[model samples]
Target: MKTSLPIFVRNSMYALRGGFLVRPLLISLALGLAGMILSSAEERFPVVSAWVPDALFPSHADPQVAQVMLSTIASSIMTVVSIVFAILLMTLTLASMQFSPRILVNFVRDHVTQWTLGVFLGTFLYCMAAMPAARSLPQPFAPVATVTGALALALASVMGLIYFIHHISRAVSVNHIVDRIARETERVIDELMPRKRGAVARGEDMEFEPEETEFAVLNVRSGYICFIDTTRLLKLAKAHKLRIRVLRPIGHFAPEGAPLFTVSHKSRLTAELDRDFRSAFGIGPMRTMQQDVEFGVLQIVDIALKAISPAVNDPSTAINCIDQLTSILIRWAERAPPATIFSDPPYVVRVILPWPDFKHLLDTAFEQIRHYSANDVAVSLRLLRAMDDLAATLNDDSMRKEVTLCGRRVVANCATRLDPTNLKRLEDRLASLEARSPSFATRGA
Candidate 1:
């Protein structure tokens, strides 16, 4: 689909942020250019190298020594770059096999690893780009200033390499990966649902019924709906005096020729209008965290499932996942639902969009993990406590009731597999979950 400029730019920015290409490429190229410019300047103005220590490069008039040093540094850096890349690839392979392949996004988006790649490659480029300046045929000239910069970069690369290794060590740990996912998910929740707790979500459950008069906009693209430019969507609807209902959920796949959206009045829909509506959407081959909160939850769920699997039964890791999921649920409970009905003016709905409610998110976050961990006492206890913690943060009775019901489900599932003593522990936790401050919701509610 052809997206509008703003929408395209946003998708591009997200791609750049998540991938390994753009940032490292930019950094390496910038450093390479800096190397060329510094070398040229020092060649013309030898005074630029006056501050260079005599011990480091004894003579500025000697080109052979500078060339050899530059060549050695360049070759050494290239070798290091290959080793670093190998290490990174190994880490990615291990993480994907052990946890989830989806988390590869997090590793690629890591700033430390990216900088490490860039700096190592940049140092090599700097040396290569400056080596030509120390040419004997050019009357014995050495760009000491440029070489010094390369030396500094090489040293910096060494330190960065050390730090990158440390980062990867911690990053591969299940605790760190789970926390990073949780934090990123919380950030998305904050951005999408900014309102404080207890604020009522307006225009929620605003369903649009299909009518014979409505016109369907078939999707020409086949991919997940990575982004939806709501501003464009609302403006298009208001200007055409039509009510628009997006037929597919954001972050979902819309097959080719499938209906993407529907307009209330077919008379107002034209060829150009169809293109504009399509332009408001951005489709990609995979789901992204740009607007998909559930994607993050699923990533963690994947790890939790693997952790609790018979092949790798790690209850402590499962408990950590529950704690992070609890953090996310609490954050979600506090934020207002995203705006669903967009109106140009007051009391008039032009665009009807729906977001994942607390119930939907609650299921997405905990249901699978809860089901899988029902047998493990530590994991089961954590799940009950997580449910209790999620409910306690909210003031909405209905939402709290939903959480309590989920807790009962947890208890029931645990009962199927737990001893009497363990089941009683869950029963006690359920009692507290069902009864909280100022009279909580009852089981019948």
Candidate 2:
């Protein structure tokens, strides 16, 4: 499915600020303020003095035991709230390790500022309430009692604060652990599940012959497919005046150990052919379907970059944003939902709704691009809103059906409204562009 970068960035910002940091701060502040107000009213009214002994404190009646009880409960609630915040922080840190670390760092910085202020306000309220009660206690031990009471409250506040900081720090550290694990896992997989010599069929037993006249194999890696230079193939094709053809083009599946080509080379050495094919295809150097999916996603990102460049110019920001977009798309494609049993075609496009929902995803995607550019909230939200539309549509069966119908109508309309000459002009420009920069120019070639 297409993505709206703006929606992604807007949601990310909200996720980072509103979830872990701002929300907790607001809750803490509200509770702290209420506590302070209640404490002040209690001090002024002197309602709870009946429970304490009047002889030890002549002017006032004994303070109610319930006030202390209530204060203790409030303190405990705040502590519990602090724990919830700590857990959220830890979860955020762990999830970020799988996707993006920068998101976690921003969460920490925002949360620290807001939570620290909240903790201070909360502590102040606790101290204010407890101090008055401590002062009313009997004579010789009065100063010692006040100090002890205040110290206890202070110690609790400090401990809560320390735990918050420690949780965030520890959560952030877990990212490194995840990274090391991923690297080691990839290394092991590369060694164990080595690329098969030839493509594999979907069926368990169906073997197929290679359809290409000339062939070469190469290993595929991110952003590139390393293959046999094709220098040997070209020489053979030209010298023999034979046509060159691609048997299993880049993305199609093939049976393992299937012949890539049948050489019609006159007077050719079988030993050389055997050696080259074994050395090249044996290592499974050819790009797989997964690689093609990644390459397609990367192309979309490049197109997105062009669409958003400042002046629609800042190529650097565009380049960086595109890289991030590519990474996101690759992850998305890998985890795309399984096709439903009733689905007519297993293609992702068929499953996705057209128009607005599509628009929204694009908008969310754009938000991310804009974030690195100028971080405009309005623009970002607009994109997010669009994404919300898409998500809503996808989740709604009626809306999805309407979108499908609308797409068919659009295609029908295009056939009538679109001028053949205009289409040719557009196609020519695209072809020219691809000739110049094959990697980023075309959607797929």
Candidate 3:
């Protein structure tokens, strides 16, 4: 169980970061507790009646007025909470139907929406927490300051509701959605690949020799490998004097009883060590942006595919998606990917892992769109332009070649489906991409 602690904590943090419940729930609870504490203090000391001017609350001493105000604020704020939730559900539904269902994750991660829910619920809880203190018990005691605070919160909730509506209105735009995904993908790129280009060789593969007695570590359950704690794995390997090789990459499914990793020495492995090895991986039902760059790319691709589908046929949206995808690829092209091998001391390998290379990411981002948008001239042209833009940004000859080849595939796929005039447009875009590549410059000439 100790070995699983890191995985549990990592997964919990990821859940809290992406989830909508934790922040709002904590905000509401904190506000409610604060309201309770403030009201209790005011009731005990009568601070408001002593310092507050009479004009502000002529009925400061009237417990009945305080009770009524607290009740009204609490009920009204609850009503607003209902409306906020209703609007949120409707917006999510509309977005899911109009856009791709996968994008709901983006909406769920929106801080604005989460804070809107928090503020509204927090106002309601604040009033409720202060309501009991407004009672005219033995001596008609009224916490005037608490009542004033409730009134202020009610006004703020009103303003919040207005802003929430405005935010939701704009959050549903496809352009906003695609741009957000692109930014998130770039953020992940910065995190996973922080090293400057040339800090690590572009195509350097980690070399390690496994012993014949190596044993497989089977996964206990079936799920997608969302995250791996490489540091912990390396530490474990170094401590045990073993070499570890991960059999599955992030974003790949690990079936129950399937080999998740292989160890150099089976005789050194124990049950505790096995648990530790398993704990280093965070598996989940679906992929997340935590470590899966392809997940982000797929989200945009999903939007593009839906846009260019026969049912939607919205080529402009597809084009926008392509543009954003190009931006994400550009950022990726400039950075060095996470190292596949982790070493404790120089020249000593502790762990060996697999990461998707640039070519795989390019295919993950554009391959499906290429197949789906074959006959659509507008989307096909935009795809070629995206490839050309990526080619210009990439310094690696092989990466540029990959982009050019993808562009060729785009043109080739379109040839069988499009008429001569449409084919000419795609071919022209492909030629333009080739012109930018050193290998194909003569062909373009």
Candidate 4:
């Protein structure tokens, strides 16, 4: 739905939505205002907090007691908030050094860390906002209801701090990191591809073809294509009765003065029309998982590669990454891919866009890891099983054939590096995998 909006607005919303800004800012403001409002209301009607003396603290006449309590809670909450931030920074550093630095994006967008910072700071502000109401000259008003509310918030902050420590402990583990990335990738797949696999054969799947057009739109800005507002593009094309072909797909970089897209018919190209066309692309310096599933896959692959390298030699970690990658591939196979050729009328193609197909996504997910893990028997065996799992889930023959080829490549790569017994293990898995695909099974028969 974000792709439906204009480019700059969507990009700004995405940055605010993904970082630690929006949620915490809104929460802190809301609680601070609540504290002020509650204090004012207590002054108008004293019955609201009238029972505080008999019930909780037994200091109804003493405004000094309320002031000290509010001040101490506010200062202590600020101290604990500093500790929370220090823990978060430490976690991000450990995750980057141990696994992959690319996963820092995931940690930045983590819900637990964001919420932990929000509640602690929010509690501190609540106390500060209510502190002024507990003044000696102001009719000796203690604002008992406001002080009681602050006490409740201080208790919640203490419990939240404990839970945050527990969460950060698990967040640094390699398994949790990869699993989280795979889950996020699958969520992106669901949003980008809505239909189920068997419900509709991926229709209008075509590659980009070169053809001369009347007008070539040059990119004014330079960055990676984080998003392509396809809905806006199709609307503009249908309105003008022309064909527009995007030269670069999502996650591609377009330097200034490059041909970003071409228009089939443009007798008179106005500056307004050109600006509208360029605004459909959301460009940024860094890649994201918004419209790019491969970005997510690469994050996990980075970890797997580091795991199997000569220095770390962490096969267990590599195998865990392989299993998680297989899960992501399965989700991809079960969903219909994005429509490459956008049509307005029944059969007329108005907008031509390029999306990464199954083969491209498959290779992006596994090709590098397969090449690197050729010598490790445990990691290699896991890769073969991953291919088999993906092949079984694929509904289309072309995708299955691609999976079959990848399986053979794994065995071939391992054949040179692995000993006889280890090589035989991969071959056996490949034969079993080939039996399931009709092309491979028929060829053997």
TM-score of each: 0.95, 0.27, 0.95, 0.93
Q: Across residues 201-298, which tens digit of lDDT does each residue of candidate 3 receive?
A: 53245456546676788889899999999988988898998888888888999999899998989889998888888888999998888898888999
Give Cα distance to truth, residue 111, candidate 1, Å. 1.0
- For lDDT, candidate 1 versus 4, the one ahead is 1
lDDT of 3 at 207: 53
Candidate 2 stretches greater than 4 Å from native = 1-110, 136-317, 338-445
lDDT of 2 by residue, 3-47 (tens): 223333433453446444565556456655655554455455545
Candidate 3: count of backbone clashes, pairs at least 3 residues apart or interchain: 0
User: Against the unseen true structure, what C-alpha lDDT does each candidate score?
Assistant: 0.85, 0.39, 0.85, 0.84
Q: Write the per-residue lDDT of candidate 4 for residues 1-445, one digit (tens) a residue.
A: 3333567787888777778899888888888888888988888888888767667867776789989999999999998887768867886887798788889888878888778778877878888888888888957988888898999999988888889889888988899999999999889988998788766544474443344465888898789899988888888888887678788888888999998998987674566777777778888998988788888889999999999999899999999999988998888888877655456455566787788778898898889998998888998899889999888887788888899998898998888788999898889999988987888985353
What ranking of all candidate models by lDDT puts the best one first?
Answer: 3, 1, 4, 2
lDDT of 4: 0.84
lDDT of 1 by residue, 237-279 (tens): 8888888888877777899999889889897788888889888
Q: Please report how far candidate 4 places residue 392 from its true position, in Å.
A: 1.4
Q: By TM-score, who's the top model here? A: 3
Prediction 1 TM-score vs. true: 0.95
Where model 4 places Cα greater than 4 Å from the true spot, the runs are 1-5, 198-214, 442-445
Ranking by TM-score: 3, 1, 4, 2
